[model samples]
Target: GGVALVIDGKALGHVLEQGMHHAIVRLGSVCSSVVCCRSTPVQKQQVVKTMKEALPIRTLAIGDGANDVAMIQEAHVGFGVMGNEGMQAVMSSDFVIGQFRFLKRALLLHGRWNYLRTGL
Candidate 1:
C-alpha cells in the first residue's frame, strides 16, 4: 500500500525550517511519494537539503527551468530537462535529458546500472 502526499510551499515552510525527522517519520509511514507544489527556489533547495540530511537515501531532483538550478545542485543526483527554460539547470545538473519522457529509461535502466556498478 502507498500514498502520495501533495504539499504546497506554504504548508511545508515550517517543516523546512526545523524538526524534519518528525515530519519525515509521520509522512513516510503513510506515503511512498511526495509532491511539493508552488515552492520557491529557496524552498526547493531547503527541501532537498532537509531530506538529504534526514534520510539515509540518495536524493534525486529534476527540473527544466532556471528557478530549479539551486535544487538541482543541492540533490545527490540531478536531472535537467532541456527545454526553452534555458541552460542554467542543465549546467547545474549531474545529467541532462532532451525530454522528460526519457526520465523513466534514464532512471530505471542507466540509473540502476550505475547504482549496481557503484555499489551505492
Candidate 2:
C-alpha cells in the first residue's frame, strides 16, 4: 500500500481530504482506508485508536518534533529523528536517529541484527 503524508494543522485538513479522495480513486479497491488532516494530539490518538479497532496490527511512528510526541507514544514503535541538536523528539522516542541516512540502518540492520541475536 502507498503512504499518506499530512501536515499538522486544521488548514491541512482540506489538503488531506483531497488527497484521500485522490488516493481512493487512484488505488481503488486496494485502498483500505483514508485519513484526513489531524490538528491535535488528541486527534492523532483517536486516529490510531480507530485504525486499531478496524484492524488490529502493530504500528510504528517516526517523527522529529515536539508536536509528534503524542502520536509517537501511541505507536508500538516510535523513532525520533535528530537532524539537529536540541530536538525534543529525541528525548521522547524509544530510538533516536542522529542522521537521516542512519535511520535505514538503525531500523533494518541494527534492529534486526539485535533481534536475531536475542531472539526477541
Candidate 3:
C-alpha cells in the first residue's frame, strides 16, 4: 500500500517544478503513501514547502545541523536532532528530544496537545 518514488535531486526538482502536482496525483492513485528523497536539506525543504502549498497535509522535518534549518522552518512542525548537534536545531525546533525513540511521543502526543492548545 505504498509508492516509493525514490528520486534524486534532479528528478525531485522536476516533480517540484509543478508545485508537487505530480506527487499529489501519484499519491491519489496509491494505496496510501509516497516516500520522496532529495539530495540536500535545502532541496528537501523546498519540496516540503511546495507540497504544503499544494496539499492540506502537515509535514514534519527533522535534521541535526544548521544545514537542516531551512527544512525545519519549512515544515508545519520541526524536530531538531539534539545532543548530537549543539543547541542550534533544538533551539529552532517546536519541540526538542534527545533520542529518535522519543519522537513518537513528541510527534504523536505533544503535537496534538500543542494543536489543541493553540486552538488551531
Clashes of 2: 0
- For model 2, residues 71-120, the per-residue Cα lDDT tens digits are 77877788889865457778888998877678789979998999999995
Better of 2 and 3 by lDDT: 3
Point out the higher-scoring one by lDDT: 1 or 2.
1
TM-score of structure candidate 2: 0.61
**Which should have the higher TM-score, number 2 or number 3?**
3
**Candidate 1 C-alpha lDDT tens digits along 1-120:** 788878888877777667564685467446666667888899888777777776787778899999999999999999999999999999899999999999999989997899899995
* Model 2 whole-model lDDT (C-alpha atoms): 0.63
TM-score of each: 0.82, 0.61, 0.68
Against the true structure, candidate 3 has what lDDT? Answer: 0.70
Model 2, residue 19: distance off in Å is: 18
- Segments of candidate 2 deviating more than 4 angstroms: 1-39
TM-score comparison, 1 vs 3, better candidate: 1
Per-prediction RMSD in angstroms? 2.6, 5.6, 3.8
Residue 118 in candidate 1, Cα distance off native in Å: 4.3
